[model samples]
Target: MAASGQRRPYPQLADSPSTASLLQSTETNHRSPEAAFAQGPRYSNTQSFTSSGSTSWNGSPTNQGVLDRRSYQTNSVSEKFSLPADPAVWGSNVSPDFQEPDDWIHNPDPKRDRKSDRGGSIVSYRGLTNLGCLVVLVVGLLALFAGYPIIHYFTTNQLSNLGGFNLGGINASGQVPEMIGNYGLIDADTPSSAHTYKSFADGSEWQLVFSDEFETPGRTFWPGDDPYWEAVDLHYWQTNDLEWYSPQAIVTKDGSLEITMSEKEINNLNYMSGALTTWNKFCFTGGMILVNVSLPGSSSVSGMWPAVWTMGNLGRMGYGASLDGLWPYVYDSCDVGTVANQTYNGGPAAALSGGDPSNGGALSYLEGQRLSRCTCPGESHPGPYHSDGTFVGRSAPEIDLFEAQVSGGVDSAGLSQSAQWAPMNHEYIWDNTTGNFDIADSSVTQLNSYAGGVYQQATSAVTKANPDCFDQNTGCYEVYGYEYQPGYKNQSGYISWVANGDVAWTLDAGGMVADPETEINDRPIPQEPMYIIANLAMSENFVTVDVANLVFPTTMRIDWVRVYQPKNAVNIGCDPKDYPTAAYIQQYADAYNNPNLTTWTGDTSAGGYGQTEPKNSFLGQC
Candidate 1:
């Protein structure tokens, strides 16, 4: 995360020499676990293998068997060839005049030394010189052995860090594995036929940074208006959608928050529904986000475009800001807004006839997404002709973990048995290559279905044909996770899309999208802090009128929304098995599922203009 303007005191870095010396001195009384590291040929210790007084045992040196310099006589060949008494050795004879033996312990055969000695009894010092070199070599090796891994893990910034250990807790290989936990699986033993669930081998220690189990109202929020998300009352929320967005559409009870859409008259508006957002009330730089959900709406309902996504908070202002988050530092024609399909502002938003300003709700909060437009260089899309072009759609750079365009078509296979049309599950992202929102870096992926056992391989276009994975109408209960800005060996980040505890696919910083012609860096990789927005959009008239006008009680049931980071943590209280959508909702069908006598704490003012819920409505999970 870019450092906030706030200054904080940090620990000083250790001086290199001092740190190396300290590492070398930290000798252990117990045998070293790194015996192999120390004994390698390049790191051979200078100490001798055997001492003169002790018989060869493990064939290694011991202080107890070291020769006594005071009693040693070089005249004896055994004494001469053995450890030639060293007065300098600790506990050995300390006589200052004690002449160190020459080739006594090193060369027991006098004939060998006589051949080299040109002057009276002089001996070659080569062995002694080499031993000295090895001593220095060992010191250098120890310094590198102790310090390199730590430095490499932090500074080198390797890509493997994304899947390996770089954050959270260290793994057996000393790298932080990319995955931390698992969620959403129906069959215990599905064939390892495709991709089976990948377990967190060492288990998870990731701390829950944010969680909205939907038991109680959360920190202040809403949309349409904002000192932060004020109660939605989202007038004409977007694209002439029929539904009037109101807080009533949201119900936080029975251990879950159910957002319902129905045909009802509200404030003179024809249809009514709910929407929730964390706008300014909460936003984070990077972390893992999970939303356990089940789409209860019929795909036959046509216009239902339910989504769970995260977008850059800068909105349209990021186009002109500097890295410090200050907007308008650099002026571009696109900043004010662009001509529909006309200018070279960055993307084809103008050409697409999508997005705000051109579509009519310019100043609205949800319409502030200019960052998701198509900005490929040299590609100029003509104006859509209705208004001035900026970004063409709700193009703000985002991580769309789960967005279903419920097509109302079912593939009769596996769990579906017969009656459900599978909705297309999508995962879309922008590579933010220019350090800001650029559409050239954008790519969209759509999965065929949310089949229960589809854990391993992503359900790509080719794989979607399998009836087991794409059966949609039977909206299955499942977990969706988005790991954002994962660490890289280069310190840059990427995003990973996970389904049922296994990775579906991933996108890196320099990733290429569908359009290969554009340079890889043309996309916008969202590095800015982002907040979560989970809403069921009618997509405003995008659905056929028949589906839009269809029925009542249309709903998007969410089990929970949780955010976690790499850290020490404990499990949340809700048990996925017993407290499933079926049991929990079924058990509390008659009465609201309130918490067990505990007081719920949150913004009581935002709710209950005419009513209110108990403090702890349902969940005590944290």
Candidate 2:
């Protein structure tokens, strides 16, 4: 009978072949756990009997099954066990027990090494380097684009402020009244020597010598009829027993004081005309001085002379030894004549036209000579006759006085000199409103003799004869149309004339002569401050004024005087010890030392040779 509660199934090989083999086998492997368990089964009476002997199955022992089963189970349960290859598996052909080659485990093949390498990639380093470079480049470009405009804006703004210092404190707001009082009218009648001229002590440590006295002997008065002659003259005015002669003879009245000249007076004072200096009086080493003068009433006259100029403090005149010496002389004259015939009596008389002589002399004379005509007349005395038949003249003819206010140190060559002309006449104008002069009906004359016109002969002659005179070596003579006349021939080294308000004449002693082509020496350079002196002249040779029947006390009034200084020297103030800078002196000294750098060749071709250098350049050269 079967077990009553539950019957357990007998453990058996399910496969028929295995069961038959097992039944037929005689010995059983006892090494297997399954065989052992099967053998331990209590007392037979279960589903099957346990085998105690070895059994065989189809040429192999069935016990191997138990061993195989137990081994497989053990392998399946092991943590470190690996799956055995099966014939059905795709890559199971590889031997499971075969050891890996050393090359495969540690030193991979060249091709495999290259393919598997994932370290030290150059791409990442290159990328990072490129990124850094790009960042730097971007930053640099940004700075360049944004920084320039900001710098320019600030630089220009600062430069503009610096430029204003040249005008000596901007606009002349409160300076007008003080200037007028300080540089106003001088009583010509009063003897400067007698009336103690008050020299102001402005802390500049400056002293005055001839404050109220005239260097020359003469009395200045005012004109009665015409305000143009606000200042007049007196003849034979003996001051301190010195016989003072009047040039113009008749005296007139104006705001200030002036003295007109007759041919006789001009000739007498010829020695004094060219250059005058105030070295002894003021001792001004460098700076500027301004003088105001009124034009003569009668423009219709030849040899009308008026001038204001300066010379070296050393006090010398003419050319040759005086000019070559350390102390030289310089002068400024207003006159007219051909460059070849620039002498008092050398050139052909200038002509006049347009107005009638009945009113005041020859209209042609007034226009051509007195009006400051620059060009030579063609054919006729007053020229070939313009549509208006008027003579040409230089509407503006005035002298500018420049001096060294302070001394700049000795140059590299150890010579004290002026680097520039403190007072330049560029764009200078006469104020007709407040003075005895009038420019209402006046016309400006082109002082440039080189301009194409009839003045070619004069211009060419002057240039050829003068050469590099008038500091020409330093290009100083280029400032004025006329060259320097270091050895001027004529008595009046520098002279200009106005004839009957129609004709004008400018004559230089050193200028070329017309017929014979004679050369005149140039006046010497000046080194001191000089005052302005403008006057009208009557001449027995060419002009005659009826002073007996004319109004007494005719006057010539000065409007104003203006002094200009170099832009660099402005606001330097008036300090005597360091009056002039080393740089300023060095500039002029260098120019003086180097002949090539300072020399200027005049234009001898055609009518274009009379052009002068600009005032600024002249200053720079000095």
Residues 520-582, candidate 1, lDDT per residue (tens digit)? Answer: 112223434455776665654434455534566677777677666555221111111211122
lDDT of each: 0.38, 0.26
Q: Pick the candidate with the highest TM-score.
A: 1
lDDT of 2: 0.26
Q: Where in model 2 is the C-alpha error above 4 Å?
A: 1-255, 258-279, 283-292, 301-304, 316-443, 448-553, 570-622
TM-score of candidate 1 relative to the true fold: 0.39
> Candidate 2: TM-score?
0.23
RMSD of each: 30.1, 28.9
- Top lDDT hit: 1
Model 1 misplaced regions, further than 4 Å: 1-205, 216-231, 299-301, 316-396, 411-476, 486-492, 512-521, 540-542, 568-622
